[model samples]
Target: DNIRLSIFVPIRDGLCNWKLQMVCKTDNIPDKERTAVFELNEGVLGYTFLKTRKHQIEFIDVSNNNNLPSTYVSLNSDNSNLINRDIKGVLVVSAFQNGSVAGLLAIDTENVSDLSKMEDNKLHSDALDWIIARSKAVKWIWRIKNNV
Candidate 1:
């Protein structure tokens, strides 16, 4: 799929920090702050993607779900370090695989009437699907490399 996955490296804080240098190469679909870096502290988007370690799509409010990691919540609150530079109506999805996050697919839009609106969007869906598919491909490549 030739997905342009942004590679993040873990920092001394034990948090996976986004590499600023790589952000420029990203597509930034739907348009957003060019200088913004993802903040995963008490934010739910970070909690879901980084803590739960699964695929997730989150809207503006970061604390709607009770399953969000307590640690993530305490560290990054809904009002603290907002995603996409505190944009009001942001739709974000994280694609993590093989126990590590490869990249995030996001879009800046008005209040979406339905979550499906984000998922059904061709640009958004393709980015997410491509990330997942690419992650799987990485696993297979690694397995073959190790002859496992």
Candidate 2:
């Protein structure tokens, strides 16, 4: 069985602070089919494939409401008849508020017989890159504004 990984990045501001959200997902199907398995609650949302052999998918949302984090939700289950019996999909929903994001990540694990091969370092590195890029871009914008 093989799975795919994906990462989503979102940028927004609320009140006086900037917020960034990154969602990661893993699955063994196409994005269109994968999307039909999960739902998002607020802000902006999107998905993409990141890798194979343990698919990962991500949903990201950004907002200004400090209390929005409590409203985040996720639901996941396996559909054996949809595809190969060994292929499974996972859904993750995350919310951010007051410069923070919180949410749930769920996986359809009926088909997965083992969890000993999962590696998440790449995902962390990708997230780090996203934050660094955003920081640099924001700083550049501020520099330009101060000069003007």
Candidate 3:
């Protein structure tokens, strides 16, 4: 299993737009970092909610800064980046109900090479597909739990 952590971000209607509240993180994440509140169209979380995209998630590993795209990267300051350096692969998908997005589901890994397993056509890993499939369940849980 290449997955080190999986997180569910519930999208709620804010004053102007939607808000991406990060929660339901696996044990690996520090409790302090797990309660972050992110806005729509902020870093990787933003890309998943783009209007032009479909209900699919792709595995992306950009541990190397050189390979990371400028669009996906977020800066808190001129020199600070939000994404952790230890993170490797990441995939995100939006969960929907009645054609409205309800939540976001994401999976990530610390092993950079493990993410490339499916890439190399060497190992059979459904981790990416699994996250996409489980997205529906994520939405179901969020709706019931948060009464959204």
Candidate 4:
């Protein structure tokens, strides 16, 4: 089994905010996390956001190390229990709209083999590609043109 976690962090002039947009295969996520907000430079999520490509979509496996990576440390004191422990791989990709990076997406998978097998399956791989393509086509209309 694999955990599908999608994160979207908007890059703005003010405090960068990270949110847990969606999740699959897990229901025990604390309510706070579902509505949790994090500064862009604050946790593994922020780190991924800042490190991703600015314009083009790029996929990166942040961690594949067998041991726990120190980067998994949570910024929230309440989450001191360790949020992403034993995370085998983290897929980070850029999202764009109108030639600008709208957000960054990160998926954490505990079982890398499961993901690999899925990637090998044509249908699954096509679905994954569709998701990536869709990410790059994001259209952010929340901001007024020229901040009018």
Candidate 5:
């Protein structure tokens, strides 16, 4: 048995609209019952809330430039509204073109009861390094593509 990994990428232009692209891979895991990992590398320029619904509203955003942090909104409430909650177990990585990155690494909702606790400078620093490494790898791949 193997664990599956899901990668979601949303691309957008200048408007606050996005199209989702998903990729799933299952060849990297040796154990099946461990845990599935989902990595979100988002370069969101801005986001707009669409409709004034109580639960499960749409978020329109152009994810070309990294300007906003990737967030996790819970949709399980008594009122059936999608409100921000302390449900952990999601990682968000935001990478900017100017060589900067921000992320929410470990989201322990039980310990972190509020949004303010999720904002940590150390996590941002680690995310920056991860983004930089990825940027370099992308550039190398692009060069290879050009050579071919």
Candidate 6:
């Protein structure tokens, strides 16, 4: 089992202020078939996460977190129902560097207990640091390719 790390950058397209353009993901998918992009609407999880620009965790229990927009509650795919049966929720974290948000990292877990236990563990910190570093690298690559 592998965790998927998605890198999103804010792009403007007329009225869309904070449109999250998916630059890359750690998942092994064909380039021509990847379409995991979304807009960071106000009060949604992506907006909230991007605003904080800090490492945080979210237990995405759609049944309980109705306040979260449908788009914010799921990450497995554009379709929320595609969530894995064993995935009780997801633990998402973000990275920021050079005074700007870089990207988001998410991991699927079997239950809340698994994620809760990771809060203060060394493994969690190490993994988070690695993910942040990778995200920064991906952002750099994206900027170079797009001449941003």
Q: Model 2: which ten-residue window has the lowest total lDDT?
A: 46-55
| lDDT score, candidate 2 | 0.34
Tell me the TM-score of each prediction against the true structure.
0.43, 0.27, 0.68, 0.51, 0.31, 0.58
Model 4, range 1-148, lDDT digits (tens) per residue? 3656554545334355334332322454444554444565545555555554543332324344334345543457644343555555555555555554455555566676655533344534454465567663333421331131
- lDDT tens digits, residues 1-148, model 5? 2112322223332366443222222354223312222222221111112111221112122122242335523222331232123232232343233332211112222232333433555654554465456654433433343342
Residues 9-42, model 2: lDDT tens digits: 3333435533223244465444443333233333
lDDT of 3 by residue, 9-34 (tens): 55556444556666677766656555
List per-prediction Cα lDDT, in the order shown: 0.42, 0.34, 0.57, 0.47, 0.29, 0.52
Error of 3 at 29 (Å): 2.0
Query: Model 6 has how many clashing residue pairs?
Result: 0
The alpha-carbon deviation from the true structure for residue 37 of candidate 5, after best TM-score superposition, in angstroms, is 16
Higher-ranked by lDDT: 2 or 6: 6
* Residue-wise C-alpha lDDT for candidate 6, range 46-74, written one tens digit per residue: 64464554665443543245545455534
Q: Please identify which of the two predictions, 3 or 4, would achieve the higher TM-score against the true structure.
A: 3
Q: TM-score order of candidates, best first?
A: 3, 6, 4, 1, 5, 2
The lDDT of model 6 is 0.52
Q: Which segments of candidate 2 are over 4 A away from where they belong?
A: 9-28, 34-98, 102-114, 119-148
- Name the candidate that leads on lDDT: 3
After superposing candidate 3 on the true structure, give the runs of residues whose Cα lies further than 4 Å from its correct spot. Answer: 73-83, 118-137, 144-147
Instruction: Give the Cα-based TM-score of candidate 4 against the true structure.
Output: 0.51
Top candidate on TM-score is 3
Model 3 TM: 0.68
TM-score for predicted model 2 compared with the true structure: 0.27
Q: Deviation in angstroms for 8 in model 1?
A: 7.7
